[model samples]
Target: MSVQPDLFDRSLFRIRRHRALKAAKPGADFLLRAVAVDLEERLLLINRTFGTAVDLGGHTGLVTQAIVNAGKAGRVLRADLQVADPNLPLPDLVCDDALLPLGDQSVDLIVSALTLQFVNDLPGTLIQIRRALAPDGFFLATLPGAGTLTELRDSLTRAELEIRGGAAARVLPFADTRDLGSLLQRAGFALPVTDLDTITVRYDTMFALLNDLRAMGATSILKDRSRTPISRRVLFRAAELYAENHSDPDGRIRATFALVTLSGWAPHESQQKPLRPGSAKASLAEALGAKEQKL
Candidate 1:
């Protein structure tokens, strides 16, 4: 199937707006900094063969700087859909889609943090990353996994259905671990691995969480829906439902963020390959029949 390039462009705009508004919020920045630190630690384990590194969806060059600080200054590149801040010290900052910017086998490492969930063609993007990497290159990414924001989503759904007779907009599209691993493999990355980490954040009220999402530029992007402003009645009702069901005994509402980290390597000819169909000595059905007869 063909990929939609426009969706990525739109997502970039949303992300840009989100970062701009929430730039001063220390809590969100703290979470992202932790992730960036973890990514740097993982990069250190790689053999130094990867002289050149490219960061996909590198919004503010945090991860890119991490790579540079690891002693790869001249070879690090940061790519994003929007024009990156020119002042952020980086070797290269290109305004382009992750799916089709870098050259074939030109980069040794491609890292994306909390960026893949908004991408509609994740497998296609992975394929592009694979193509951009030299043999033995690595692709590392972090995305929101399923179960993120369950409390907010469920409360919104229940309240919207009760008040407006329909569902509200979905906040995000997160992938499961199995599907993520398969996608990496299908994209020609070898030794695919995925692991999940759950983070639960407490908010004094549901409205506080909602405002944080807005400041973070996490509004729904459903184009077909009406752009009319949400009514105060609906908002209050939603908050009530959220507090009743999503709040803890201490009165703080909880929001869950499930981070799924993925890693894969570019394939090499030296790797083992499965035997071709009809090349095996015996079929599974034949082996089963023989075993039954012996029994």
Candidate 2:
């Protein structure tokens, strides 16, 4: 069988994220910080405190600070695809997403913030995370869902097709919330729960939105993207199309970012488990006294 092509270039993505962090623009990482805040809130809901934890792909260490502030962990190690600065306040460890550096069942908690979506092998990454977590250990995270950046993707594709007679994959295909639970289960997580929330931010123009994406190190790193730089004419036309189709009453363009928050625990006997098939004692037909029809 032919090997499948990678959806993203992991090396390029790491470099872009490092570049964005180096730029250090004010409010450029507002989205990442926002997700970290939300993740911290969710972590607060868990009653247990972890002894040792790792924040995988923790860019700029915002989530690490959140974990520390909440007293969620006795020790939190920060890991990322690229080590942008070793002198940062947090203790940092450089590692790849698919293969974590920790030993099996060595961590009590594993939290990721605005990461995982960029991984070329998401399923493998989750499996590795599961292996790193001790029994009953928790996993919490917020990542971009399939609906994220839909407007921009549409606008760009339309512009490319019109200007260059074709469209390349310009946006990463983020995982859908519907598939999250299944993936967690497949990765050996217990009591996995997933939900999505949409955040719509309005911008004066498409250029502003694009600028924010670049500053956030979120520009497309699709492996099969066109080697040539984006032409100015194409960008202008895409901006025009975005405004025409996605503009609100105030003349501001609306960008929808659907974030999927996932929570799961490593399997342990103490954790609750679903009953076996055919274990239920009652049926709806009996409770409601409804007539049963056979197919």
- Using lDDT as the measure, the top candidate is 2
Predicted structure with the largest TM-score when compared to the true one = 2
Q: What are the per-residue Cα lDDT tens digits for candidate 2 across 241-266? A: 99999999889999999999988898
| TM-score between candidate 1 and the true structure | 0.82
Off by over 4 Å in 2: 281-295
Q: Relative to the true structure, how large is the alpha-carbon lDDT of every model?
A: 0.74, 0.86
Q: List the residue pairs that clash in candidate 1.
A: none
- Cand. 2 Cα-lDDT: 0.86
TM-score of 2: 0.93
Clashing pairs in 2: none
Q: How far is candidate 2 from the true structure (C-alpha RMSD, Å)?
A: 2.2
